[model samples]
Target: MKKRWVLLVIVAFVAVGCAEPLTKTQKGAGIGTAIGAAAGAGLGQAIGRDTESTLIGAGIGAAVGALAGGSIGRYMDNQEATMRNQLAGVESASIQRNADMLAVTFKSDFWFDINSATLKPGAYTELQRVS
Candidate 1:
């Protein structure tokens, strides 16, 4: 039983940890799964009073929680894609998405003249499109 719990924990961590940081939906799912598993295990222990029931409850809860959280940041995903498409031809800017955050960076030299603080005339059109 202890070994099973340890394996389950390891698997959960592995599922949540990947080379790239998780998006909002993935993050939500991981959080939901952990919470659901704990709640289910507690309920199962209280109600069914058996190890088998606890395990079954945990599995069911995890699945439900994952499904519920799957679309948490879907709108952000669409917006990011749209922004990428709109900025496709621009060579002076770049976008980076990390989890629920979206960052857009523009080259200062492209938008400004040397060390001047004012944006170049051509930069307005690009900025307007972004807005």
Candidate 2:
């Protein structure tokens, strides 16, 4: 069993190393799979000493985690596209996404008056609609 596990690991490493570069979603899934496998192995060992239990746990964890991670990437892609379209012709705001988080940044010059912390007059209405 230990040899089998070692062989599996070697095979997996070789396969991935020989493969083409992964996309963002694929990278997310790979990260998820690693995390999930570790968690599953820990849980499996705590519950039982058998390989079957470990494999089952790992499978379930990988499936759930991969789906979640990949879906999040896809969702971010969709949102970024939407944001780009929505902000078209409006250069003051920009949207950025990395992994699971999204950020929308607005140029301070557009919202604040010079040398003042207070918002410029009529800024509230446009900002409200954007938000």
Highest-lDDT candidate: 1
TM-score of 1: 0.58
Per-residue lDDT of candidate 2, residues 81-101 (tens digit):
777777665677887765456
Query: Per-residue CA lDDT of candidate 1, range 49-99, in tens?
Result: 999999988888888777766655555567888999978889988999865
CA RMSD (A), model 1: 5.5
Q: Estimated TM-score per prediction?
A: 0.58, 0.62
In the predicted model 2, the residue pairs found to clash are none
Error of 2 at 97 (Å): 4.2
Which lDDT values do the candidates have, in the order given?
A: 0.82, 0.78
Worst 10 residues of 1 by lDDT: 68-77
